[model samples]
Target: MHTTYLRDLYHLHWPKVILVMLLLSVTVQEAVSQGQGYRRKHLEFYDDKPIHYGILFAMPFTRYAIKHNEQFMTGDTAYSIKSPTKAAFRMGFTVNAFLNERFDLRTTPSVSLYEREVRYSYPSSPEKIDKRESTWIEVPLLVKYKSQRRVNNRMYMIAGITMAIETNVRRGRGGGVGTLDTKSTDFTLDYGVGFEQFFEFFKFAPELRFSHGLGNVFQPSQNSLGKGIGRLSTHTVTLYLNFE
Candidate 1:
C-alpha cells in the first residue's frame, strides 16, 4: 500500500517538483566568499539596453465583406444583393520603445485607401452605375510581446486599441453633390504577429506584420443615408525600417 501511494504521489507531483527546482536554480545562486565579503547572484537575469524611440512603416494586405449593402452609397441596387472582391491599401508610421528585450510599446498613425465597384441596374431606366472609394487616417497604440530575444532580433506578437480620425473621403462620383458629408471618426481594436530583425547600424529593424480593424469605419446615420449600413473594417500588412 505504501509503495502504491508513493508511485501515485510521484505521478501527481513530479512535474511540479521539477518546476520549483528549476525556478529556484535560475533565480538564486549560493553566495561566494571573495576576500572580505560574500556576494549572491541571479543566474537567469540579463538586462538589455533601452530602446530610445523609433519609427515604423507598415503596409497591410486587406479585404472586405459589405454587410447591409443596400443601405450604402452604392449606385447599383444589384450590388446590395451580391458581394465583390477587392483589396484595400494602407500606410503607417509609429513611435515605439522597448521596455525590455521581451516587451515593447508603440503608437502608430496611419492612412488608408479603399475602393469598391459594383454594377447597379435601375428598374425603370436602363442604366448601370459606375465606381466608389473611401479613405481614412487612423492612430493606434499597441503593446507587444517578444517570444524570444537574441542579440539583435526577436519574434513578437502585438495587441491593442486605436482611435482614428477620418478625412478626405470620396464616395462614388457625385457622392457629395449637396448637403451630404462623408467624413467620420472611429475607434478600433488591432491585433497582429510579426518578426523583427535589428541591425547594429542606426538600430534599423526590418519587420513584417499585419493589422486588423475591429470597428466600422463610418458614422451612424440619422436617415436612409446610413441606416442598416454595417461598418467596414480595414487591414494592413507592411515592412518596417526602425530607428532608436
Candidate 2:
C-alpha cells in the first residue's frame, strides 16, 4: 500500500506540481542572468500607467475535502472513502488598477470546466465512483504587492477573495442510487506568489496560487451514498501564466 501511494504521489497525482517546480526553477535562473546584465529595461514606464490589461492562462488541480457523518460509522456498505486531485484548465482576462509603486488591485474573470470525483470502497464489491462535472464563472479580486524591479524581473505576492457561480452542472448517480450534489455558489480565500519577467512587448509572470473554500458545499442526501458525507469543501492549487 505504501509503495502504491508513492507511485501515485509522483506519477499520477502530482504531475502539475512537478511541472510547476521545474518551470519555476528554469525561469528563476533565467531571470537571475537577465538581471545581472546591464541591459536596458524594456517597459521602463509600463508601471506609470494607472491601469493595465492582460490575459491569464492556468492549470488548476482541485479536490474535495470530505468529512464523515454518523452514518459512515454506523453503516456497513461503504468501508472507506477517498478523494483524488483532478486537473483542469482555465482561460481568463486580467484587469489591473495601480494603487502605488508597490501595490496593484487586479481582477481575473474566467470560465472553468471541472471534473471532480469521490471514491467509495465496499466491503465485498468493486470500488464505486461518484463524479461531478460542472462549469463555473469566477471572478477573483486580488491585491498584488510588487518588489522593486531589477533590470527586468520582479517578484510579487497576491492575496484576495474569489466568487464562483456554478453553471451547466451535470450530476450523475452512483450505482443507480442517490447522487451527490453541491451548492450553486462558492466563496474562497486566495493567496499566492509569482515572479515577473519583462519583455520587449509584454510582461510575463508565473504564479502559484492556493484557494480554500470558506463554506460547505455538500447538499443533503436522498440515499446512503451521500448520507455518509458530512462536509465538502473545495481546495484548489493552480499554476498561472499571466501576460500583459
Q: Evaluated with TM-score, which candidate comes out highest?
A: 2
Task: List candidate 2 segments past 4 Å from native.
Answer: 1-4, 11-36, 170-178
Instruction: Look at candidate 2 and tell me the lDDT of residue 238.
Output: 84
lDDT of each: 0.50, 0.83
* TM-scores of all predicted structures: 0.55, 0.88
| RMSD to the hidden true structure, all candidates | 16.2, 3.1
What tens digits encode model 2's per-residue C-alpha lDDT throughout 157-216?
Answer: 999999999887555433246467778799999999888888999999888888999999
Once fitted onto the true fold, the runs of candidate 1 whose alpha carbons sit more than 4 angstroms away are 1-51, 69-92, 113-135, 169-183, 203-212, 218-231, 235-244
Clashing pairs in 2: none
Candidate 1 residue pairs in backbone clash: 59-237, 59-238, 60-236, 60-237, 61-237, 76-120
